[model samples]
Target: MNFAEKYLSIRKHTEQLCGPLQTEDYVVQPVADVSPPKWHLGHTTWFFETFILKPFSSNYQIYNEDYNFVFNSYYETVGNRVIRTDRGNLSRPSVSDIYQYRSYVDEAMVKFLSNEIKDDVNELLVLGFNHEQQHQELLLTDIKYILGNNPLFPVYSEFKSEILNLPSAAQKLLNIQAGVYEIGFNGDGFCFDNELNRHKVYLNDFAISSSLVSNHDFIEFIADGGYSNFNFWHAEGWDWVKSNHIKAPMYWHKIDGKWFNYTLQGLKPVNDEHSVTHISYYEAYAYASWKGMRLPTEFEWEIAAKHFNWGERWEWTESAYLPYPGFSKAPGAIGEYNGKFMVNQKVLRGASIATPEAHSRITYRNFFHPHLRWQYTGIRLAK
Candidate 1:
């Protein structure tokens, strides 16, 4: 994809997510987990302007020099930024005003990409695009969480998940003979800061489940006192269970007679065919242990993903999210993307239904604290 097309397409996807949102919905910032919609719009623009535009364009000028402080998300070396927690306080640049800022950025970015930018700018531009795509997903998830928390249980958009009957009878697990396999991105395309410095990784003989663990499978576990059974949980998992009193994954609310999961499109009857998301690594580990299975290491997941379209749902892996071998922090602010979270986080493979297709890829590694279930997280079994 050329510069304008790819950039504009990503911009459209971000805008589309906001299209269904109300003005009131844009400003609800509930803790660090959920960023205001206006923040996402401004922050993504900051990524491009700071990384690609200013460095590459000799004559580039920031739309608002003050915005560099307001929206510079964690780029320590780049300069001071607005304190993260106070993001909700910047109410002056209203959601509508932020949209105008995005448009202003679009004009400048298009002009830069169309002519004056050097060919070397292409790679960084792709990185900026992928970075924006990541924020787009975050925008949806954060918005959904914020809206769902409203007493009335407002939905940002329709949760239109179609339960498809995969040709179950025809589907069979494909055995990829174990060997040393190269994991991580080596392709000449856009990938995140995490999937870099590609190299070889060894794997043992292992079998991946034909599909992700389903909602039905999870329900059975819950029905069998999965949450109450201490034997099935790790010490940490048990502690988490008791501390939070988590009966089930977040969003799986038990109504009068049955369970319903809140989704982006809205609340829907839990579909058994869909991968059971919102599962934590703690719960996923317990479920795997109960079934005599394990979560695949990042290496195993990447090897298997070589043969699939990376699936519609991201599969949780046993791998703790970490930087690749010989990984070095990127100079300046861009370094914050992946280097910081190299510990105490697990890797997730594949992508979710809400994830943009352009952003999905095999080597993509998503990481979060083991306790976070708000993202579209699920499990794939290994043995």
Candidate 2:
């Protein structure tokens, strides 16, 4: 597909994901990390308007002068934006207003793409496509969180569930010989700046699990007092567990001595065959430690990724989210994309069931605070 075709398809899918939601669901933000669904709709539209049409399209008209303040997210280079925590408080924009804004901006984007596009403009266009795709994944997870936490235990959609039916494979370790290996995005296709400077790293011989940890395995961890034992956790992780009173993964509930978790389909019995998800990096690490294993480093995960089936959950890695060698930020607001969030975060390899098609690549580096488990995160053991 051409750029315009790809652009429209991606844009349409974003709206389709929101089709299952009630109007009230659009404005709910249960946590600071997850943006309101309406905010995501407006923010993604603002991206195209702010970056492409404003600078490149001479005939383009500004949608709303006030929208810059409403939708701008973390782009200090652009201007001030609604504070993160206050996004849910933005009930004035209204879901109707945001959808209209999307329609308005999307029309301009379609027109702009019809003209002769320069190489630089094309680059930003691709970024706009991906930026929305990132939020598309977030939309699903955020909607799940919003509904899962409700008193009614609302179901987002009966058709959407993370649990997948696949033939059970025997769990074993895939051995990697100790040697120097190359990592990072080596393709000519578009990749975030963080995946640049494809470079070499030396590794000790290690073996990584061929399959993700299942719900049954995590239940065993809990039965063996994994959460209760401080010896199995890092100092910070143990504190996180105690302060938050975390036992199982997010959306998990123990009732009548049985495990149940909230999925998009509403509350259901925990499937032992499905991979255990909604796991924090700390939980993943503690579980590995309890099993006398470890989570693979980002580089190790990337090197060994081909040997396993992923795309089930965002697998947490034992790697700090640091810049690769010779990595530099792009000029202006775009530069702020991934460079600013490198600290106090852990890297997660692979993609989740919520991830969009064509969005997950082997070299993609997804990072989040260690305590977060709202996303479809899971564990993979290495030693």
Candidate 2: worst 10 consecutive residues by lDDT? 160-169
Clashing pairs in 2: none
Model 2, C-alpha of 215: deviation from truth (Å): 0.3
Per-residue alpha-carbon lDDT of model 1 for 183-216, expressed as tens digits? 7788777777678888988787887776778799
lDDT of 1 at 80: 94
Candidate 1 worst ten-residue window by lDDT: 162-171
The digit string of per-residue lDDT tens for model 2 on 30-142 reads 89988889998999999999999999999888988999999999999999888999999998888998889999988888888888999999999999999999999998999
- Candidate 2, residue 20: the lDDT equals 91
Taking all chains together, the TM-score of candidate 2 against the true structure is 0.99
lDDT of 2 at 369: 93
